[model samples]
Target: MISSTAIAAPEIQHWQTKNGMDVYFVPAAELPMIDIRLTFAGGSAYDGDTPGLAKLTNAMMSQGADGMSADDISRSFEDVGAQFGQGSLRDMAFMSLRSLSAKEYLDPALDSFTKVLWKPDFPETDFKRLKKQTLIGLKAQLARPGSIATKAFYKAMYGDHPYAQPSSGTEESVTALSIPQLKKFYQKTFVAANGLIAMTGDIDKAKAKSLAERISSGLKKGEAAPKIPAVKRLEKSQRIVIPFPSKQAHVFIGSPGIERGHPDYFALYLANHPLGGAGLSSRLSKEVRDARGFVYSIYSYFSPMASAGPYIIGLQTRGSQVEEAVKVSIEEINKYLKSGPTDKELNESKKNITGGFPLRIASNSDIVQYLAVIGFYDMPLDYLDTFTSKIEAIDKPTLLDAYKRHVKPENFITVIVGGEQG
Candidate 1:
């Protein structure tokens, strides 16, 4: 029952610079525009006791660099109608730019990107201002019930691991971080050897290669990244109930799931779609929202990362119904683990997953992202092309086996926020 939909993507060009910089490009001549993305291996995962190091480094890159004031930098980009932005996840930091194809503007935009990457000054004045703003944001998030619940969940699951550190550092941690610590972090991490550039838009092979070289010319190829130790596995189930004054009770139930490189990713991914990946049609939503009406919305997902990621099921409901909703959800999980999906459900899930896969790589920009990911994770060249076929081929028994091996409810962690009674 899987759709034989053919998924096509623009061919990706991959290469590496002499300085160990990986490069990926996808050409689209029609749009007089290009988007460039650079990613480095160290992110929040690299933050030592001085949490927020990676994020702070990324934020300060644009604040001032190469003797340019933050305002001057902003005005330079605004004059050309271009944008430069930065982001970080647990594993990598990303800096990207989008600009008009005109060389007069594009060259300067690229120059600004280079300046941030290679010559950021990390001005103490700007650092103080950004730190204050970051702390305020952190305090605001701590006031929310969902934030408290998630923080508690990570603490329970990851304990003192680097994974326990929130992407946005705690208020106390941010307030304690100084400009000197940020400088050392920048030197220790962000290096050419750990970085790559991904570009998409109007450019030929020669021009693209030259553009990459010009931007990365001054980068110092640094040492290999320090190895990140593997995440420790939890041996037993843990539960925490928190009471708060609120209209609804928020619940989260989860356990460690597959990593990005796990061989079972394809099977588990396909299996998850029918269970909760689909919106209204997914079993969790259908049972919890439509049939029983105990909750307004319910969702479940596994975020595959460098290490085992949290497999989570979350819901919000009337305070009095929290225990009932939790009971029903556990029952559903037990059933799914033991019996797996029916043939009809499996087929529909495959069809939806396969049919929708093409949208994931619909354009040059999309191809660039995929390329960057594949490069970062060292995935095979055929990953995008073979994705649909792989999903279509997953049978019921295989997925069931993976689920049984991975989803052990007894080892899961449950956190409840704003529920007076559990």
Candidate 2:
């Protein structure tokens, strides 16, 4: 049962910019600050033959723009006490700004933000420095067991798909990247039509609309990116083991899961919590770490991207205990696939999930991020309002059905790094 004090979902205001960008706004007058996010359909998925181009392009955004050096851009926002953030994921690249709602601060912050989007200089000095830093980081990651396991797991699961490529491109790919390629990718991907804007906090509808227009106007008008192709399910199970000298082995198990808008998403989401997502109380944690003392940590999660993302169960165990840990995990998963959760487990999970839902949107910054996701993925406008109700409605049979249909234990691909087999 939900609490009486559960916060009601805020009303979202939606509109479209003249150049075809979708915008979602929420007015929260309680705070004197505003948070804004601009999302574009230009993540690593659009890298085409240039694997790390998207991440590199995003990294270059604030380095230099509108004839200002990176320091100048930094100073511009610092003067107004605004915060700037930019990053790329598998399916989207996003830029965020948090500033005081007053026009004195908001105006200058917006000017700097728009200039970065429209006039990135991609200065030669910054590019060389960043590229060198990326290579060093990649080299460090390559030596880590967890990183090796993650890359191999994705490669084994996705095969030749774009999802197989690491969001941060390989050392070879990063080294091969040039300024011309980065500029071309920026021109094609960062456009008005491919954008979504979300804002929350002290702003009126008129001001929100104006802000959206100002941001979108700086982008070139171009067509939306092509849809990512559907992922083909694996027909057979495979295990890949890489040799490393670590005392513990990193293990990753499972296969490609559902897409963002899949009908079974919520059902599977609720079901996964008890399995491995609930930290120390999770089934995987209890069985693998607590009961058997195999490792310090173990967890599972589904990364539902625009295309079918991975459903991964990850853990680390002493090299000597690797086989037993894998055996127990598989047995537990198979049992779950056949028999579903108990009534008590289902009810407990439901209450836990519902009770915590309010925390997700408790802050204006959090709300802005959620709004950006809704606009970018075309999720229902009432998504937040209906979230708790939907989770509460899930029953054991519905959850079991969704799990059986989406997660196939028979076709699992396992990756282990740092053990005898590895």
Residues 309-421 of candidate 1 have per-residue lDDT tens digits of 78888899888888888888888989899888888899889878878777777665677777778777777767887888888888898999988888888888999898554
Worst 10 residues of 2 by lDDT: 1-10
What lDDT would each prediction earn against the true structure?
0.83, 0.90
What TM-score does each of the candidates earn? 0.95, 0.97
In model 2, what lDDT does residue 196 have? 88
Q: On a 0 to 1 TM-score scale, where does candidate 2 land against the true structure?
A: 0.97
Model 1's TM-score against the true structure: 0.95
lDDT of 2 at 62: 92
Query: For model 2, which pairs clash?
Result: 243-422
Candidate 2 at residue 93, lDDT? Answer: 95
